[model samples]
Target: MESVVGNGCFRLVREMANIQGRDVFVADLYVTPTWLDPGNTDPLLHFPKDADQKDALIIPLWIPGHFLLSVMRPLQKEIFFLDSLYFRRADGFSSQAYRELLRGLAQQIVAGAWTEKTALDLKDVPKQTHGNDCGVFMIMYAWYFAMDACFDFGVDDMCLLRRWWCIVLLENFGLEGYGRKFAHFTDEGKATLRDNVPPVFRITRKRKLESPMVSEDLIQYPSLQPV
Candidate 1:
């Protein structure tokens, strides 16, 4: 099985846009190489100059194939590392390495060597039951964080949550009828429907009234004057 999930970071970007009600700036997946790369600070510098003014920076990280999310709160000077697997190991881009890297970047961005390192918080965010669901959990984390909501769902809910995501996406793009059409189907059924439908017919149709082919004079009607 391919380790990388669909759309990678773009999925998180879309969810952020939907929940934050504003455009979210996301760095390319290539920004940070493997989490183990010592030169990971370069990606932090690549953030937009005005990134500090935004609510937070949502970063999608790839450990070779597995996925995770890193959220940086500039104003708060805090960085949160959310991993669905949460493996307890000391090596290979463990939480400590990320914390140190974030601290260095924080100091560099502030332009003050004396500036305190940003706080690093390792959250007990939701975990995935299956190996393949890390990407889904990453998306859920971004969605909940963007909306300032709690991560209340778990792995068992992922199957249904995936379908709900499609519905939300369609509704957001003004395809309510299509969203409703698939609302009652199972996720697999919805996927089959989506696969079979052509892109041109996915949108709802608008009524087009044909223009009158004959001149108004040809029509019999009561005269404007007294009949």
Candidate 2:
């Protein structure tokens, strides 16, 4: 499979795009159910660029809706950007155990190692409450974006199985926990968390850690608007 230039996530999407020869959208949050229509473009093709990087323009589709639904919006709030699944090295604050485990899990999924039931078992790894619907849509949107972007991966590369494992590992290290602990209502994390559970084997109100990120600021990328 192809790897994007800047980060693995970017590379993964780009590679898919290169192979598929299509556009990609990376929504920062969950788009409302009716948000994608003739007046709007696909939610996955827009992304903003950093001064040091050069990627195709990506738009942020911020969903404007009801409070409960908005809470379910993935890109409707601020968020921390970390593609922990494709960590390039062993250094940094990441836990080696979690990294190794997630990498193996991703590999297994790519190899078609698990079943839908197993994948669903790990689906709610982080056990979240606020972003339940948003999380589901985020994963769906990411995969949709990746697929439409036309990268090199197959059903396995960025499949739900791989994504589930990614969330499992993410929760193990409390990465999402910290975000939840201090996140605000409009914050992707809701301003603070009082619970932490295993991503793969837990049941609680909070959304799973491996779930797609929900942040409004990330949606600020201007290219996300319908063209």
Candidate 3:
């Protein structure tokens, strides 16, 4: 199936425009739910690019309403539950299905891999005390997780994070760099992360988030927003 460039999470997915062809998948609830459906004739068209040649796949899932996320790293043979609220895998409907789907994805990417499947229980991940920052948190978490970048963001970093998001989107709206580079999947990643620093972008957020990413999440499903 030819992959469509769809990158989404929630309200941004009604038309189901998610990013693909880079092993990064971020689809909306209703649309991507079809991927897990047994009757789907071509589920791969949803996301998770050409798995045959890619080094890894990163799937950042958003549990609707609350929008918390679980990152599926198929190549690493593991899935990371990055819940700002510290929610458990079994705490929600979508989270529960993600584990099994990840295993399926692992098998598709590499047979018999990721067999010891388990969401690596992480305790030090930054949490959102009480705010609508879950989506923002998911975006940052996926970037740091996907790029294997340092985890320096905290509750105090939210304002900066939001502002940074704004700048990046404003500047990158017309860029064509999506699915081209993914050092984030490499053992010795060469991808440079600038989120830790101040913003130098065209400036662009608020109002359900207007992510200026090229597309795809766990593309933070850097699948941050729709095109």
lDDT per residue, candidate 1, 34-104, as tens digits? 43566534655668888766666666666755766666666666656777766443322335665566666
lDDT of 3: 0.49
Q: Which lDDT value does model 3 have at 38?
A: 62
| Candidates 2 and 3, the one with greater lDDT | 3
The candidate with the higher lDDT, 1 or 3, is: 1
Against the true structure, what is every candidate's RMSD? 13.5, 25.9, 19.4
Model 3 ranges off by over 4 Å: 1-31, 36-42, 47-49, 52-55, 87-94, 113-120, 174-227
Whole-model lDDT values for every prediction: 0.58, 0.31, 0.49
- For this target, which candidate reaches the highest TM-score against the unseen true structure? 1
Task: Between candidates 2 and 3, name the one with more favorable TM-score.
Answer: 3
TM-score of each: 0.56, 0.21, 0.54
Flag clash pairs in model 1: none
Point to the candidate with the largest lDDT: 1
Candidate 3 is scored at a TM of 0.54
